[model samples]
Target: MEITMYDTLLQLPLFQGLCKNDFTNIIGKVKLHFRKYNADDIIVEQGAPCTQLIFLLNGEITSQATDNQHSYSLFETFGSPFVIEPYSLFGMQTNYTATYKARTNINIVTIDKLFVLNELNNYEIFRLNYLNILSNRAQVAYEKLWNSHIGNTEEKILNFLVLRSMKPEGKKILKIKMEDLASLIDETRINVSKVLNDLQEQGLVQLSRKAISIPALEKLTEKNK
Candidate 1:
């Protein structure tokens, strides 16, 4: 069967539990803006006023943030249909926290903030779903802040491992290159490689060409304590 836009939106966290009739009600009430982006397109820049709640319907997008040193760091990459920066829609200073760029040809659906507010007031499920999504994002921000305070390279590596491995799909394996991993942690590739070598010797992880497999995730988590 051919899936419709409503079907895709239903799979997203914001609309997960919402039925077709609920979606129909939403469609009837809000004017959704659709946009198509080619690879390398800037979807939204950091500090730009956030006037709409954007939902990525197809393709991939990368979010990057600049630190105090003016260095850009990769914040996240979203592949499936999901809300982008719902927290930015509110607050006194309503702006995007990071720059979002399309990594491939992308399609997006956007709803105005006023309409979103109305929906939140009208639908209990959407309000709960949005709150849960925001909470998860806040937790991730907390982890990044916590990781930044660790001064030891080995400890930082362990913390990074623990954080990523906590993900459901990242339970045993971390499929990332040493260079990219180094960039993520703001360390040199050599330093990351040395730490991985030490981890391998300690039987904490098994390293290959493109991935690092943790034999015992608890071993890495225990080191963080």
Candidate 2:
């Protein structure tokens, strides 16, 4: 069982460069923590303090962020071997930016910040991997902003979603009213509605009252490109 766990750790981003020997040493060094959740279970709520590095081992989960005024929530789904916002751990706003929930039976392993600071930091490879991930996230965000521009109403909406997304490709859910969404994207309500209707007709999104469900963000991205 421990062997399987070590192998799984190797697949996780934060532990990627570490060899089997390193994982074994870490396991022996700390009281490893594990947790599980059933489908639809809430793993963590938005604004909660992030005191540990939470790694999703298997299954899928979604992270949701709400606008400050609680206008609408943005959600993005990700699969296994995921890390839940590692950058939040040491920032001025130490709270998790989103609420995360399980989309399947999920298993997670977490390393407390203290161990990450005192012990994991001692490993040169581990420190480099950590720094790389943080740097990559910042760089991606910076580059994406340059790509964000107002095009057609459809492209405007797509850019809005993609810019806020954790990953460019995933299942996405945008819960906002037509007027609110239109105002945010700087499009007319009628134009927004017309484009959304056209998208729905094309089977790209399923629209209901105040919600737009995108089953495959990648498919829509591919179609546009």
Candidate 3:
């Protein structure tokens, strides 16, 4: 059977910035498919073994989980080529903690897990690249988990603002809903609203209908610390 390559794969952040020839070579070994799903369609469920390294070509993925008290939505819409779980490729036996669903029509390219491992193991560059990506993802996950549990409400809010700043175009206005902030900090919407109100009163964050923007981010972080 002949495998077809795709240009869209190069557009994803994971493959973006890679040399065109390098991406093309990788695509040559991949199997391309367009997966269409409606909102709430399960893309990958918890406890299911990861068979392929799914490169999300388009649309959004939401990961959610429920604890004893309430269900927490970890992500509302994370973008493409985000690995659902990297350890799946390493033969780890742990079950998935969260369920992944499509927030809209989703397009994906799935490469054979075995094929990628075999090729990457033999190629030093590919091995380094793969490890680097996994390490970065792990760190992000760790930070999210750690911040949600230990920090005070003020500290949590400050940390979120600083984190956004670390990304590209960090100075741009962040218009996030109260619910997203609450979810990120593991607080209830009501609690988040109260915190936001206090921050507004103290001139830490500015609040408006449908948006909460942080103006003096550095000062807020220092105050929290």
Candidate 4:
């Protein structure tokens, strides 16, 4: 079945609870600019000024952040029609928190920040949705900060696995290199290798050159608990 833009909007968390009428009103009020990107294209650089809300209409992208040591950590990978850091559009910094690069040929829709602000003020539902989105982002940020401070290597590894998995059942494949994983966790390659070996021996993960697969995600979650 073919999906319309309205259908795509409905799939997004930011547009949840908005009816067809709301979407129609939004389309009438806001102009959407469409663009395409090839694999490895940089959509936005970290710390770059951001004045538009970007939506991934199709294909894959990864967001990465650089630390004080200039090491890059994979933040998140996103698929179609999802907003890229909506909260950043409003804050005083008005800068992208991470660099977004196309992981595949991609389609994008962008709306100016002024249009977003106008909609937020004119529509009660849009205002509430925007606020809720910001709140959720803040909560996730808090959890990441808290987790960084408290966990041991093993615990942190398990927590990171759970987060990357995005669920507690079915197989989960991590498309990352061991070296990058080490950089992500700020650990040495040898240490990260040892930890992965321990997890493999315990039957929580299966390692291969291309990916790490968790056959039973629950087993990894059990370690986190």
TM-score of 2: 0.94
Each candidate's number of clashing pairs is 0, 0, 0, 1
Q: Could you give the candidate ranking by lDDT, starting with the highest?
A: 2, 1, 4, 3
The worst-scoring run of ten residues by lDDT in candidate 2 lies at: 143-152
What are the models' TM-scores? 0.69, 0.94, 0.59, 0.73
Candidate 1 error regions (>4 Å) = 1-3, 68-72, 139-152, 157-193, 196-225
lDDT of 3 by residue, 15-63 (tens): 5456666766665664555567777788877767777667676777766
lDDT of 2 at 197: 94
lDDT of each residue in 1-225, candidate 4, tens digit only: 134867886677667778888778788878879899999999999999889988887898877665445333434566776788787887688898778999899988888988877774577766787899888767766665667624666776666655533223556566577887777777778887898889899998888874676677777766677
For model 2, residues 181-221, the per-residue Cα lDDT tens digits are 89888889999999999999998888999999988887787
Better of 2 and 4 by lDDT: 2
**Candidate 1, 197: how far from true, in Å?**
7.3
Tens-place lDDT per residue, model 1, 137-203, is 7788677667753767777776665453323222355566788778777889999999889889988
Candidate 4, residue 178: Cα displacement in angstroms equals: 9.7
Q: What lDDT does the true structure give each of the candidates?
A: 0.75, 0.88, 0.61, 0.73
Tell me the lDDT of model 2 at 187.
Answer: 86
Question: Which ten-residue region of model 4 has the weakest summed lDDT?
Answer: 66-75
